[model samples]
Target: MKELIPLRLSILGHPQRLAVFRLLMRRYPDQVPAGEISDALKVKSSTLSSYLSALLQANLVTKTREGTSLRYQVNMETTRETLDSLYLDCCRGRPDLCTSYQQPVAPKERHMTDRKYNVLFLCTGNSARSIFAEAILKSKGQDRFEVYSAGTQPQSSLNPIALEMLKAKGHDTSALRSKHMTEFIGEGAPDFDFVFTVCDQAANEECPTWEGQPISAHWGMPDPVKATGTHAEKSLAFHQAYGVLQHRLQGFAALPFDQLDRISLQNAVDEIAKTSD
Candidate 1:
């Protein structure tokens, strides 16, 4: 108790550190990049490092590596504990202020249930990125999601490179084909629970509004179709796209959808972009 007070006080005493902590708490529960944090707070990199280090030492914040990017988030448990300790001390002799202090409710547990979610992956040509995402998620989701892919402009045929890559990895390429996005929007189509745009072009293009107000996110990636140079280079680009989609889809499948509410699920989907290549 003697040692804890000063540790907590030292973290809260500095204005810059407090600002960074508060900013993280307000923006996202997942995590935000250091560059975004610094930009928003108008703090220099050297100075931000010192502030982040202080918070980290006090256990008020945590830093994690997502690929090559560094993400920071508030350590809510420690912050709550420190605040609770202070309130306890001040409320010992006072009753009125104590009356309104309620213990924070814990977040609900996230777990997968039997209910299957419908998801759509969209892209411009439905050739590489979206097709790969759909195939990967369908296999990895383990029948937990009804996965589909479509495009604004349907290709005459699926990209040969994407097909070969999936087949090499033991993914079934039988049912996969390029289809227009309008097919899903018309009558008798499965209402989607989640929709993700896997390329910048489709994400920006105007499209039919979904029926169920499904949670949507942009998981933009470089188009492998435009890869130029030697045959090996083009093949490698497709391989990399496949790998990136595999990583992203695996993370998506691991999410505890039954436990998280709509907003949390949306946030989780968006955070995947930061963690992926």
Candidate 2:
């Protein structure tokens, strides 16, 4: 067997270091100051400095002096090589799977800010994934997408597991609650740009088309509460679902909805719903 490379070992051995690397990767090619890293990771400057030094030594990150401050950014060339090496190591001699796992190219940015769109998420329980999808889109989408969530049969309280997962991810959930879809369906309900059914039952149920006849989509996710296990086990399920929703919603929010025609907008929603599965 061929020897595994040192860079792969360095990264895989230190989970915290890998997390820092991911953070930098997410903000790729952007020079971030030490304080930002410290804040994001909740690590003290003194502690983070040691990790940063190790990364610099490993050639995973590059540092530049900006006045008295030092900015650190991912060394993309080295990072790419490291990733390639890891892929080769994992696949051993299987070139097909290794080649098939190439990173996807980012979609081209479309300039479409002339109009605004409102989105509504509906589910049977409205307690876990639906609430999470709503909160994430509202926070991440900002002015790009107006978002809300409702339930067919509303729960008396928000799901504790869902709230905990959101707070753990540094998201504010104080303003989130379980609301009835009826509140938004009648005379007072604001017309939605899109209405999404996040549960199978809600998707199949016969209901009046939305007031605005908004584009409708279905995204079905397993109920985290149905998982039978300890509290920790249940929490893990919620966290996993939260991650999936967060990733998909981020992409959906980034779409140029204003520029797309109705058919195009519907297509965009359909594409995003596919990710939920």
Candidate 3:
């Protein structure tokens, strides 16, 4: 136990190694490709290898092969054991002193008004894909970004299938409604920071000019409304659209926005659309 404690401490002592551990911790049960981790942390291949080697020696991480790629995953059980040991040393049998361990709140957990980035999702009818994007982002973004959805030709109401899918996923559907993209035009409209077109038709059409010239991308997908099949098959199409949007939005939320420049952020968003589909 004495030897293992020092070994784990040594592995975590380096800043770069600690950063990699934290990244792997965030991913937890899901393993990440080594290349992706390298890109995300901005560490060179040689440097990352050294860091990963230290972690592996201490049993702080695990690796598995997927097809041709090697994926690294956090050894969460070992991590928790190490933490428990450290806490025991500090508490020294005083149960009251180590009753709970609170994780430090992150900067992104701050109030939305403090540092809110506005996002707009555009589609042909603002019915299914756009509405799904809005709900998913609003729910997952956790006040880090303000999200709105609109269409070139607004529908009178939200699509039923879309509402059903969201509701099944425990998202509130009462207040969601369809609206025209024109609402974002003229004075008093939000100067968006990012804009995403989720339908091929909307992506091909000319969009209204925004005040801030937001970073825009087309995450184009087939319209769920046009799915012509059995009730089960049609509903499945909406579910799939929800899934693709969820994957893309999760990827976006995971980005280190504070560290990435506009060009990099644009590239990341584009890459997500390509890979998520």
For candidate 2, lDDT tens digit of each residue in 91-111?
A: 674657763345222112233
**Residue pairs in steric clash, candidate 3?**
none
> Which predicted model would earn the best TM-score?
1
Candidate-wise lDDT, in order: 0.78, 0.72, 0.79
Error (Å) of candidate 3 at residue 206 is: 1.2
TM-score of each model, paired residue for residue:
0.61, 0.57, 0.59
Give stretches of model 1 more than 4 Å off. Answer: 1-112
Q: Which stretches of candidate 2 lie over 4 Å from their true place?
A: 1-115
Which residue pairs in model 1 clash with each other? Answer: none
Q: Is candidate 1 or candidate 2 better by TM-score?
A: 1
- Where's the lowest-lDDT run of ten residues in candidate 3? 102-111
Off by over 4 Å in 3: 1-114
The number of residue pairs in model 3 that clash at the backbone is 0
